[model samples]
Target: MEDEILGKAYDGRLMRRLLAYLRPYRGQAIVALVATIAASALALVQPYLMKVAIDRYIAQGDLAGLNTIAVLFLLVLVGSLAFEYVQTFIMQMIGQRIMFDMRMQIYGHLQRLDLRFYDRNPVGRLMTRVTTDVDVLNDLFTSGVIAVFDDVFTLAGIMVVLLVMNWKLALVSFSVLPLIVLVTQWFRRNVRDSYRTVRVWIARINAYLQENISGMSTVQLFRREAQNYARFDEIDRGHRDANVASIFYYAVFYPAIEVVGALAASLIIWYGGGRVIQGALTLGSLVAFIQYSSRFYRPISDMSEKFNLLQAAMASSERIFALLDTRVVVENPAAPRQAAGGSGHIVFDHVWFAYRGEDWVLRDVSFEVAPGERVAIVGATGAGKSTIVNLLLRFYDVGRGRILVDGVDIREMELDALRRLFSLVLQDVQLFSGTIASNIRLGNTDITDAQVRSAADAVHAGRFIDRLPQGFDTAVAERGATLSVGQKQLLSFARALAFAPQILVLDEATSSVDTETELLIRDALRVLMGGRTTVAIAHRLSTIQDMDKILVLHKGEVRESGSHQQLLAARGIYYRLYQLQYRDQELRAVARTDAR
Candidate 1:
C-alpha cells in the first residue's frame, strides 16, 4: 500500500510520458484545437469593438456606424459560442474514447500477466490504477489541456491588441504579472503535492478496507475486530488530513490572484488618465489597453489550475504503463501441435520444477499413464504431489524436462486446448458465485438440464440437491458457504462429470465426504473414471487401492511404482504409507463403535 509516486508527481519526464495516450485521438483533438483558436480569436475582437464605439460614436459623434457595428458584434458572439461548444464536445468525446481504449488495453494486459504478479501486488492498488487513474486522465483532457489552448490564443491576441492601442499604458498595467505568475505557480505546486498525498492515503484506506472485509470471519474468530477498527481509523484520518490541506490551497489561490489583478488595474487607471488629460494618448485607446491587460493574464489563472490536474494524471499514467509493460510468460506455440491419435496418453520424461528456481520441488519425476487407464500419485506434505498436476495442467511449465500427451510435447499445444482435454476436481473445490446447475456447467454451453441431472445422480449429489428449495437452480453462496463441505465437493463432482473430458483428475475427492456419503460417491467416481485417462492425487491411500497402478513419491522423486498388491509386498515406502492409513481407519471405527 505504500505510495508509488509520492516523490515523482512533478517529474517533467513522467508527465510527458502520459501525453502519449493523446496520440491515438489526435484527429478529433485537432478539431478541438481549431475550435478553441476560433473562439479565442472571436473573443479578442470584443475589446477593440468597445474601444471604437466609445471614442468614435461618443467623442467623434459617429452615430451612423453604431447599428451596423452592433450587428457584426452580435454575429461574432454567436459564432464564437458555437465554436466553443463544438470544441468542448469534441475534446470530451475524444478523451472519453481514449479512456475507454486505454482501459481495455490495460485490462487485457492484466489478464495475460502471470499469476505470480497477483501474488506480489495488492488488488486494491491495481484497482486504483483503473478507476482513479482513468478519472485523472478525464480531468487533464477536459479541464487542463483544453484550457491551455484557450488561454494561449486569448492572451497572445490580447497582448498584440494592447501594444497596438497604447504601449505605455500596457507596460504600466502588466508590471504586476510577474508576481501573479510566481504566486499562482507556487500555489499550484503545493496543491499538486497535497492531492498526491490524498491519493496515496486513499489507496491505503482502500487496501485496509479490502483486507478487513474479505477476512472478516478470521478477525471475529481471533477476537481481533477491535484492532482492525483502530487501524482503519488511523488510515481514514490520514486521508482526511490530505484532503483538508488540498482545500486550503484552493481557497487561497483565487483571492490572491484577484488581489494582484485588481492592483494592476489600479496602476493602469492612474497612468492612463494622466496620459489622456495631457493629450499623450486618446481616452478610447487607453480604455482598450486596460481591457487587454485584463484579458492577457486571465489564462495564467487557468494555467495554474490545469497544471495541478496534469500532475495527478502523470502519477496515474506511470502505474498504468507499468502494468501494460508486464510480459506474459505462458504462450502457445507459433505453430499448432496436435495430439497424435488423440488417445490422451501422457508421459513425463524426467520432469523437474521449482517456482523460484531456488529449490528443487520436483526432481527427475517420470511416469506414464496409458489411455483409458487409472493411476494414483501418493506423497506426504511437500512431496510434489500437486506439483505434478500443476505441471500437467500447464499452470507452470516443467523446468528441466519434457511432458508429452499422445506423443506430442504438451508445451507445443495451445493452453486452452490442453486444459479442455481434462476434467479436474481439485482438493480445494472452487464454486463460483452462481446457481448449482450453472456452476456445474461452467464454460459448457451445451450442457442440458437433463445432462446436469444425470451428472448429479452419478455423483450421488442429487439426493441433497433435490431436497433444497430451488434444487438445481439454488444459488451457492460465496465459495459455497451455504452448503456443507461435502455438499460443495459433490457439486464439484457433478461439475467434472458434465465436462465429459477425455482425461479425468480427482485430487482427494473423497476426503471431505462422510464415510456413508464417501462410499456412494466412491462407487460413482469409479464408474466415471472408467475408460478415461485418470490421474488421481490421493492422501487417503484406500481411495487409490484399486487404481490400476500407484506411484509412491518421497521428497521430489518417485520411490516406488507398482500395483496395489505388488507395492504392499515390496515392504517399502508404499507399505509404510498403507500401514499408517489402515491403522487410522481401524482406530476411527473402534471409536465410533464404542460411542454408539
Candidate 2:
C-alpha cells in the first residue's frame, strides 16, 4: 500500500506532460510572470525610499524633501499593489482554464475507453482523477510554479540591495543561510512523504464515502450501520492522522525559519549598529539592512510552503498522466466500413471471449440471425448470454473469431456507426437527471419534442408520464429514483424506440416490472420488434414461446437450438427448462394426490 501511495517526488516526464496543458494559456502565463517580476522590483523600492527619507531629508532636517519622499513611498506602495493584483488575477485565470481543459480531456478519454477499463477501476477513483487530483494541479499553477519565480526574484532583489548597502552587514545576515537550508531540507523530506500519505488516505476516504452512500439502503436493511460506521471511522481517522502529520512538519519548519530569521536580524542589528557608531555605515543604511534581511526570510518561508505544493503537484501529475497514458485497447479501424442499414444480418462465427486471461466466458459459440428475425437465447445465470449482446455491441472484442453485420466484420465498422444499428435495453435501466422529454431525446437536438412524445406514447410510458403534474417536462431524479421500476423500464423502451435502430436487443428488460407493467411492455416490445432484427434473453420461457428460433445455452456453448415446440419435443436442455417452469402446476397436483 505504501509503495502504491507514493511515487518519485519529482518526475521530469510527468512535469513535461503537465506543461503541455499550459501551452494554450501561455499568453496569460507570460503576463503573470512579467507582473510578478515588476511586483518584486517595486517591493525593493519602499525600503530604499525609507532609507532616502532618513538620510537625505530627516538627517538634514529638510521638510520639503521629507514630504516629497513620503508621497513617493505611498506611490510605490500603490504600484506594488497593482502589480500584485495583476499577477494574482492572471495566474488564477490560467489555472482555472487549464483545470477546465484537463477535466474535459479526462472525461472525454474515459468515455472513449472500453468497458474493460471501467471493470478494473472503481468509480470513486476516476471521480478523484477529474476533481481532487485536478484541484491539486490548480494550486501548483497558482501558488507553486509562478509564485516560486516571484519568491526567487524578490529574494534576489533584497540580496542585491542589501549587499550594495553594506557588504559586512549583509555577510553577517547571510551567516544563518546554511542553517535555514539544512532545516528546510529536513522539512521537505518528511513533508513529502506525509503529503503522499494524506493524498492516499483522502482517496480511500472518497472511495469509502462513495460506496457507502450508494449502498446506504443495503447497509441499513442489513442493520450494518454500526459496522459501516466503524469502518468509515477507521478511514476518516487515517485521513486526519495523515493531515496532522503533514501539519506537524509545516508547524516545525515555519517556526524554525522564523527563529533563524530573527537570529539573522539580531546579527545585522548588532553588527550594523556598531558600524554606524564607528561611522563605517550610515544610520539609514543600518535600518535598511535590517529591513532587507527580514524581507529575504519571508520569501524563504513562502518558498518552503510552495515546495510542498510542488511535491503534491508532482504526485497528482503522475496519476493524471498515468490515466491519460492508458492504451485504448479497442480502437476504430483506420478505414472503417460504412455498412448499409442493419439488414440485421448478424453472425457470430466460432467466437471466444474472456474478461481476463484465458478464462473464456463464451467459447466456440456460433450463431446467425437474418434480417427481421426474432431469436431468443435461454440460459441459466452466467451462461454467457449477455456476453453475446456485449460482443454484438462491440463493447468487448472477441478473443478469437469475428462477428459480422451485413457480411462485414464489426471491427471494421466505426463504433458509433455500428452501435447505431442496434437498440439495447438491459435488465437494469439507467436514467440521468433531466426532464422526461430530454431523457428520451438524450443529446440529439434533432429529435424534436414531438418525436420524443411519440416514442414515449408508443412505449405506453406516456400514460404515467401524462399523470405527473409536469407531464413530459417533469424532472427525473438521479437514476429515475422518482419513477417506479416499471416506469423507468418504460422510459428505456421509449429511449430505444426514439433511436429507431434496425436491431432491438432485450436482456430480461421486463424482469423487474409488475405483471401489469409487463403486459404493457410486452405490447410495446411486439410493436418495437416488428420488422426489426430482435434478440431476446428471457428467464420466463413463456415470453419467448412465439419467437422464430430459441437457442438453449447451458454454459458457454449452445446445447440446443430450434423453435419452442421443436426444442421441447427434442427432450433436451430446452425441454428440461420448459418442464421445470411450465410443468410446476402439474407436479404440484400430483404431489397433493399422492399425499391423499
Candidate 3:
C-alpha cells in the first residue's frame, strides 16, 4: 500500500536528500559532467562540419578543402566517442559506490532499530527497500541525473545555432513545439500510473514468495501446493499486466515523437527551400537548418524519458527515506552508566509492559534472582513468559517500571554491555550457513578451536560431531536443515556455553528435543548452569523440578513463587499443571503396557 502512493514527479525535499549521497563523489560527478558537456559540444560540431563540407568544398569544386573538412569531421566523431566513454564510465563507477554506501547505512540502521520495529514491518518489504528501491536510485544517478544535462545542453546549442543561422526558418521549425509538450505530458501521466502499479505488485510478489518458501515444508505436509500455485499465479499475473501496460505507453510515445520530428523537418525543408530560391538563404545554411532540426527533437524525447526516470526515483527515494527516518523507539542513554561487574543479580521492580496500547502482556510483574541462582518460570502459552526474557535483555523498554542489574537501571546501561551479560537459547535454533566450528564460535575470534571443541564436548554435542566425516569442520545448511532438531539444540547449547556469559537464559530450550536427547544434555545443563545465574522456561515440569526456585505465572501476574516441592505441596496452579502432565504420562504408560 505504501508503494501505491505516487508523490510528485520532482519532490524538492526528496531530491535534496537523494543528492546528499552524491556529495561524497562530488569530484567524480564533476568530471563526468564536464565530459558530458564536452561530448555535447563535439556532437554539435559534426552537423556544422557537414554543412561546410557541402557548401564550401563540394559546391566550390575544391577537392583539397573537402578532404580537409572530412578529416576534421572524423576527428570530432572520435573526440565525441572518447568523451562519451569517460562520462559513462565515471558515472557508473560513482553509482556503484553510492549504492554500496547507502546499503551499508540502511543495514546498519536496521541493526540499531528495536525489535518493535521488526514487529511492525515484514522482512520482505524491508529487503525490497535495501535491494529494489536502492536500485531505482542507482538508475537515477547513472542514467537520469547526469545525463539530463547533456540533453539540455544539446537542445540549447541546437536552438541557438538554428536562430543565429536563420531566425525565420528556426521559428518555422519550432511551430510543432506545443504538440511535443502535449504528447510528452500524456505519456508521462499514463506511464507514471502504470509504474506505480508495477511497484506495488513487485512488493506483493516478494512478500508472498518469501513467506511461502520459508514455510514450504508446512505447505507440503498439508498438501497446499496447488492452492499456493494459484495464489502465486494471481500475483504474477498482476505484475505482468502492469508491465505490459507500461510497455504500451512506451510503444505509443516514441513513434509519436518521431512523427512530430518529421513534421518539423518538413517545415524546415519547405520554408528554407523558398528562402534559398529567393537568394535570402545560402544552400549551406538551409542544409544545416535541416540537420539541426532533426537533432533538436531527439533531446526533447530523451528529456521526456528522463522525466519518467526522475519520477520513479522520487517514489523510491520517498520509501527509502521513510525507512531511514523511522525513529528508534528504544535507544541507549546519552550518558550511559557502566554496568558493575558481578555474578548476575537481576530485579524487576513492579514492571509493566504492553506490546500494543493498554493490552498488557506483563502487568506489575515483580521478581528477583540472587547471584548464581537458578530460577524457572512456568506458565501457559501467552502467559508473558518470553516477554520476561525479552525485557531482561532490554529488547523493549518497560512501559511503567524499572529493571535493574547490579543496582543500576538497564535503560541507563549501554545496550551492548547490557545484552552481553546473558546468552540466550530458544526453542527454535537459528543456525547460519557455515561450518560446525564457525557456528559455534559465531565470528568471535577469541573463541579458539580448542574452546569450540571443549564447549561442544561439555554439551555432549561432540558425540554426534565426532561421528561425522569432517567432525567439527562439517558444513551446516541453511537454518541447520542438515541436522535434526535435537542436534541443532545441542549445538545451540554449545554456542551459548562457549560465550561464557554471566547469565544463562533458556526459553523453552528443551521443548523440541526428544526424551533421549533431552536426557543427554541433563548433565550438560548442570555444567552450563553451574555457578552461573540461570533462568529457564520449560513446559515440561520434570526438566525443571530440580531448579533452585520456580515462579508460577497466571495470566499476566505472578501467582506463586517457591521451590518445585514447596509449590507442589500448596496445591494451586503449579499443582494443577503437574497433575495434567502426570495424567498424560500415566495414559502413555498404560498404552505402552497394553501394546507389550
Candidate 4:
C-alpha cells in the first residue's frame, strides 16, 4: 500500500498532480495570489521610504517635511499589515477547502474498494490515511505551498531594488551571500532527513495505541497489563527520542544561522561605511543596504524552520495518495453481458475458488437448486461450506467457470441489485448502533412499523424485544453489545424476514442460540421459507433433517445428497454425522439424569 503512494521525495510532477486539485479553486487562488503580490510590494516600500525620509526629511530636517514624511510612512505600514492579514486569511481558507474536498474524494474511494482490501489492510492504517495523511496535506496547503511563493517573491523583489539604488553597496552587502546560501541548503537537508524519521516514529505510536485499544479485553484477561505498558513505553520512548532529535537540530541550527546573519550584518556596516566615507555611497544608501542584508537572511532563517513542516507534509501525502490510488481487484465486468433471465434459480457450474492462490478449497463444484427448493449443506470444519454461500452472493468471483442466478451469470448483473434479491443471516449477527425498527428497516427500507413488528414476532425475537427498555424503539449498542447472542441472532432473523427475498440463506444462524430459542426460530423460518428457495448450513443436524434435500460436502466435493430419510436409508456421510451428534447428546442426557 505504501508503494502505491510514492514517498521518495517530491515526484517532480507534484505541481501538476497537486494543481489538479487546485483547478476548481482557480478564481479564489488567483485572488489570493494577487493579494500576496500586493502584500510583497507594500513590504518593499518601508526600507526605501526610510531611505527617502533619511535623505530629505530627517537629515536636512525641515520640521514640516519630517512630520509629513512620518505620516506617509505610517500609512504605508498600515496598508502593508492589512494586505498581509488578507493574504494569510485567504490562503488558509483555500487550504481548508482543498482538505475538505480531497478528504471526501478519498472517503468515497474507500467505499468503492472491495472487502478483500479490508481483509488485507488494518483499520488503523486505513484511518491514518484518512486522518493523519490529510492533516499533512492541510499543512502543505496553508503554509508549504504559499510560503515558498511568498519567500521567493519577497526575496527577488528586494534583490532587484537593492541593486537599482546602489549596485556597488549591494555587492558589498551580498559578499557573504554565497556562504549563507550554502549553509541554508545544508541545514534544510538535515531538517528534512530528521523530520522523515519523526514521521515514521509517529505512525508507529499511532499503530501501537490502535492495536492495544482494540484488544483491551485480551490484555486484561491475560493479566499482562504491566507487560503491555512496558511495551507501550518502549514505543512511546522511540517516538519521543525522534521528536527530541528533530528539536535539537532546530534549536541548535536556527540560532547558529542567526549568528552568521548578524556577522554578515556587521560586515555590511563596515564595508558600506567605508564606501560612504569615500564619497562613493550616501547615508540613505548605506542604511538601505544594511536593511537589505537583514531582509535577505530573514527568509533564509525562517525557511530553515519551515523546511521541516514541508517534509512532514510530503511524508503524509504519500500515504493518502497510496490509498486513493489503489483499485479494487473485484470490479464489474467490462462490456458486461446482461443477466439473460433469472427466476431466482441458482447454479454453481464447475466453480473453483481459494482465498489465496494455488491451495484450492472448492474444486469444480457443481450444484443446482430449482426455484423454491430447500437444500441444506452439511460439512465439518474447513469443509469450504461458507465459500459456497460467499460465491452465491458474489462476495468473490469464481476462479474458473461461473455461477448463474435465474440462468444468467451473476457477475454480469449490477452487484447491489443482485445481492438485494436474497436475504442472508450468518452466525456472527452483526448489528450497528440503532433502534430495533431501524435495524430491520435496513433489510428493506419500505417496510412499515406493522411489517417490522410482524417480522420480529415471526422470528420469535418479539419474546424478549418488548421487554427491552423501549421495545422496538430500544437502541442497540455497537454490534448489539446490549443484547445477548441469541437475541442478536433472532433480530437478524427478523431483519431477514423483512426483506421477503425470493431466496433465503441461513449459515449457522442457530449455532449460538439455546435449544428452546432455536426451535422457535426454526419453526418461524420454516414458515418464512415456504415459497422461497432456502439453503441452510448448520452445525447441528436436527434442524436440517427435514429439508427437501441435504448435500454432504468433503474435500470440496459433494459426497452425497438426498433427503433425511433417503440419506439415513443410504447409510452414507449424512447418516453417520446424524448418528454421531444425536448419540452423543443421548449419552450426555442419561449421564446428567443418573448424576442427579
Most accurate candidate by lDDT? 3
What stretches of model 3 exceed 4 Å from their correct place? none
My TM-score estimates for the predictions, one after another, are 0.91, 0.95, 0.98, 0.93
Ranking by lDDT: 3, 2, 1, 4
In the order shown, the candidates' Cα RMSDs to the true structure are 2.8, 2.3, 1.3, 2.5
Q: Pairing residues by index, what is the TM-score of model 2?
A: 0.95
* Per-residue error (Å), model 1, residue 438: 3.0
Which of the predicted structures, 2 or 4, would earn the higher TM-score when compared with the native? 2
lDDT of 1 by residue, 458-545 (tens): 9888999999999998988988889888888888888988888999988878786688878877877876797999999888898888
Better of 2 and 3 by lDDT: 3
Top TM-score model: 3
The lDDT values for all models are: 0.83, 0.88, 0.92, 0.81
List model 4 lDDT by residue over 1-596, tens digit each: 35223254555465467767778888877777777778778888888878888887788977898788789889988987887788788888888898899889989999878766787898878887777778777787777676777788888998899889887767766777777777778777776776666666777777778888878999999998999899989888988988888788778677777777687778878887887799787788778777777888877777766666665666676567667889866676665655554456888899888888878989888888888899999999989999999889887778888998887788887777678779999899879788988988774558999999999998888879999989999988887878888888888888889888878998987787787878887887886788888888988888887788888898888888888999999998888899999899999999999999
* Model 1 bad stretches (over 4 Å): 1-3, 6-24, 58-70, 282-287, 475-481
Instruction: Give the alpha carbon lDDT tens digit for every residue of 1-596 in model 3.
Output: 78667788899989999999999999999999999999999999888998898888988999999999999999999999999999999999999999999999999999999999999998877988999889989999999888999999999999999888878888999999999999999998898889889888987898898889999999999999999999999999999999999999999999999999999988878888988899998888888888888889888888988888898899889999999999987788999998677569999999999999999999999999998999999999999999999999988999999999977899998888888889999889999999999999899999999999999999999999999889999999988999998899899899999999999999998776678998987778888998999999999998999999999988889999999999999999999999999999999999999999
What stretches of model 4 exceed 4 Å from their correct place?
Answer: 1-6, 304-314, 334-342, 443-445
In model 2, residue pairs whose N, Cα or C atoms come closer than 3 Å (at least 3 residues apart or on different chains), thus clashing, are: none
